[model samples]
Target: MLLFDFMFSETLNASLVQSSLVCLATFSAIIWWLRPSRSRSLPPGPRGWPILGYLPNIKFSEWCNGYQTHDVMCKLAEKYGAVFGLKIGSKDVLVLNDYESIKEAFHHTNMNDRPENAMIKNIDNLGTGILFSCGDKWKEIRKFTITKLKSFGIGKRSFAENITIEAECLNSEIAKIQGNPFYSRPLLEPATLNVISSILLGQRFSYDDEELHFILDNLHRNGKVVGSGGALLFVPSLQIFLKDKIKEYRHNLDVVLKYFRGIVSKHQEEFDPYIEKDYIDAYISEMRHNKDKGKQSYLDVSNLVMTLGNLFAAGSFTTSETLSWAILYLTKHPEIQKRAQEEIDNVLNQNQPRLEDKPSLPYTWAVVLETMRLATVGPLGVTHAVADDTRMFGCEIPKGTMIMPNLWNVHHDPALWSEPNEFKPERFLNENGQVEEPPQLIPFGTGRRSCPGEQLGKMELFIFITHLLQKFNFKEAEGESPLTLEGSLGLTWSPTPYHVCAHSRE
Candidate 1:
């Protein structure tokens, strides 16, 4: 009887202690909520649920469809005006619609950091690469990559020659298809990969290389998965809800990383820093130099992998997808197609088109520009995060806020362009029939985190598209008369599978 009574007393005391702790926690939360430093004026936005944010308004159905997603966001921008707020999962994202706002927001150094999301958040090592990294690490890598790419022939004639050769190979591959209805991916992908791969590893994969094909296919699949933005992509913990998808994501990334690792490992042994070869050699030299200083933070193995991964992913898809758009647009508009062909023929005249001819082939270049504007490759570019408390055009954006620059809105704004819906390459042409670079045509985005691969991509598009038009004509398949402009939006937006007959001009 005495033992039972003593146990009951102990239980009661434990319950009382638990109650006190709960009360203390409750009080602390209340005090924190009321604290002046804890609250600030967030931009106007729709309120969301406890964990899930404004995802309800931005429905999955619309997101799954590329065109529909833009249409929805366009409507929201119309209602929300130039600046509004949203909560993508836990991310407090601020949408900058107009060109001026986007320019100003992007230019702010405080707004330069890449937003922390599931994609980078769950990375084995957080903030390691050029694309998803933040702060000094990102800054260091971006600058280093741009400088190295220049030395390795990215924006130079030598690089253009490399792309031209790839174009020749691509033309040959397309010829093998014999003008039959075929998916453009298999042909376009390998050629694009070869260009970037040559720049990175100093070698290009043959079209029939099975291992290379595996990397290309998975790279594309991963790109699409990343493009299909999700809660887990923005909120890492939500990955718990997508066990199967997370497994696939990890597997795909592993395959690509393993392939790159093999290349990087090979380069580590054969790399000669004193003699410049490619991006890999240049990076190894940097790592070697920094080793003595004990400041080799950014030039290690993992970083090399992530940076190369991004370069591969970014350089490959957007350019190829833009080419896909080119085929779709030009084929659909026979008159436009004829004009482009005329320009190519006049400029080259029995010679293969070169980057030197880009300036001379104004209409052909204009077609490329218009395609970029019409179906912007990166519609919602890499999301950025606010570094500190900042203001943009009177909107108060607190620290840790995410910035979503709607390239679609900027490209399609009625106030910015007349008849924005119409496919008019001539708009990019001047009275003297020269190609004019539109200040607002920011398909690759603007400011700090904007695509460093833009110049390379432009050169590739011009060389490949012009050469293809020079060699053959892209035609509609028997039943695929009207090529649908509808695209499947992923990390990059690409056209839906459509059959095109490549007719040899010879």
Candidate 2:
């Protein structure tokens, strides 16, 4: 009886211990399941559904409701702070909303690379272009392109002469309109396209050319599609639903490339190594040199075609759109326009504005700066990628994470600019009546990957605006509804379609 009692007690103890172990494991698992899965060091963000992640949440933002992606991002920034994270589809995206964060993030060497997307990959097969390429390829092509652009007088007085010629052509085109209210884009786009064309192809097409019209039409359509189809970059699976848009975008791109390829072929047939007539000639010369040396080279015909496309697409549309926005703003605010014209008249004294006169025309320069700030073209400048595992704003950013610099938010931040929505050129002016460019006003962006055409763009704006204001007065069309200050977002943010009467100042 004693031995039986001992065995029974031992069995009971073993059974209780087994039950306790199972209960402990079950409790621990429940706790683990309930806890946040994100690491404490990661940037705080809204929880997302499995697989789909914050993609659905972003779609619900103003972007899907006919507003801009930058607007949606700004609203999210207000809720989640300046630096926020969102798991967009399978990608980790970190949006930097404030100027400091943007500056810091962009200045980092590891943050200089662009994120890969299905759209970019499809458009640039070998990824040889300067805009969307990465690593040594980007470095090499960009350096070579810059050197060639400078050699070709991109930001020099000689280039300003080319811009002046274009400006005169534009004025002549406007003069032919005879102060009639007309759509500005039709006139403005061809003018800007010609300026870039003069450098790239050593030629310019007349505004009436069918080829010019074809190129402009396709490019405009592509810009709209790029902005609308941005979601495909995040959720590539969305392509199934947006196949039509994808198809259209690709078609437009192919049309532009085909046109450029024909131009490049002509340049090749007429190639002169001794005297480089244009960027194409310079590139062809370098390509032949590389072939002669038998060195591996990125300077192939494919890269040249894509590079030319990048230059044209980037160089033409942005300046023209900004000028359009400036016209709209001036038309809406005639008083400001009058002041700017008065400044131009006082500075130039019936002479056409020149690049050398920029300092003398501070108010005019301020107007250009103010227009850029308010317009915020290229709102989300370009998506950057984290090249390696990094920590930013006290949070861990993993390798391959995408970075979005919210330039719109930075330009419109109420704390930085009083009445940020108001178009006040005086904001860029100081008590000394000089243009004061704040560091926060980074319209062309900052850092190594900033717009290469920045100086050229600024020169164009200065020369074009000064020349236009000097010659004509922009005013709203009679019988038309009041133009909205609100802009439609595309590859660039541009004013809604509005007609303006370029009443000749003469």
| Candidate 1 lDDT over residue span 291-399, tens digit each | 9778846767788888888888878878888898898888889899999898777768889888988789999999999999998877777678889988765667788
True-structure Cα RMSD, model 2: 13.7
Which digits, one per residue and each the tens of the lDDT, describe model 2 over residues 189-263? 999999988889999999999988888888778766666555455456445545666777777877788888899
Q: Which portions of model 1 miss their true places by more than 4 Å?
A: 1-40, 60-67, 119-127
Clashes of 1: 2
* RMSD of candidates 1 onward, in order: 10.4, 13.7
Question: Best candidate, lDDT-wise?
Answer: 2
Instruction: In angstroms, give how far residue 506 of model 1 lies from its true place.
Output: 1.8
**lDDT score at residue 362, model 2, on the 0-100 scale:** 89
Residue 160 C-alpha lDDT in model 1: 95
Report the alpha-carbon TM-score of model 1 versus the true structure: 0.88
